[model samples]
Target: MNNQEQNMKFMQIAMKHLPEGKKILDDKGIELNMDDLQPMLELLLNVMSEAYELGKEESMENKS
Candidate 1:
């Protein structure tokens, strides 16, 4: 409805699919250090940008 309500709804939906903190290191044979966090974040950013924009487009229909 309002900006605050919209943000809360977005967070609630996003949290369901967010990776658990420890999951970033799930590969057994592969190891990652602090340097890996940036690349991981970049990949996630691309996915989330598409997801959030698609959600916003859907919400615009409701607002109309």
Candidate 2:
């Protein structure tokens, strides 16, 4: 289990989950079309960015 092997395995598992995730979203009435993907990914990225920033701020406060 070298780093490359581990990374490949992780990616394989992640790829398998992608369709399951899309299925879940589709069941919830979300669209998976090309027109919808951009906005959907953008929204997810924005949320992840905000969450990362919040976590960083919390870590800084804890260190003070």
Candidate 3:
């Protein structure tokens, strides 16, 4: 997929699990405002994208 499509997919996945992330923070008695949330979400997306790339590379190596 293109970069835009990959980013969109990452966002969808992140949003889907957002509630779970919030729950974890709530259990820890941590609260985040919008400012904090934005960076956290960006970090999550970056990590997810890197992980996806790593897995794709591994799969290609295995196929070879």
Question: Best by lDDT, which number?
Answer: 3
Which digits, one per residue and each the tens of the lDDT, describe model 1 over residues 1-64?
Answer: 7656755665555455545543645644456654765565556656756687799999999999
The Cα local distance difference test for each model comes to 0.61, 0.66, 0.90
In candidate 2, which residue ranges exceed 4 Å CA deviation? 1-17, 26-31
Candidate order by TM-score, decreasing, is 3, 2, 1
RMSD of each: 5.4, 6.8, 1.2
Off by over 4 Å in 1: 1-27
**60 Cα displacement, candidate 3 (Å):** 1.1
Q: lDDT, candidate 3, residue 50?
A: 96
Q: For model 3, name the residue pairs that clash.
A: none
lDDT-superior candidate, 1 or 2: 2
Which candidate leads in TM-score? 3
Number of backbone clashes in candidate 3: 0
TM-score of each: 0.52, 0.58, 0.86
Give the Å error, residue 11, model 3: 0.7
lDDT of 1: 0.61
Candidate 2 shows a clash count of: 0
Shift in Å, residue 21, candidate 3: 1.0
Give the clashing residue pairs of candidate 2, or none. none
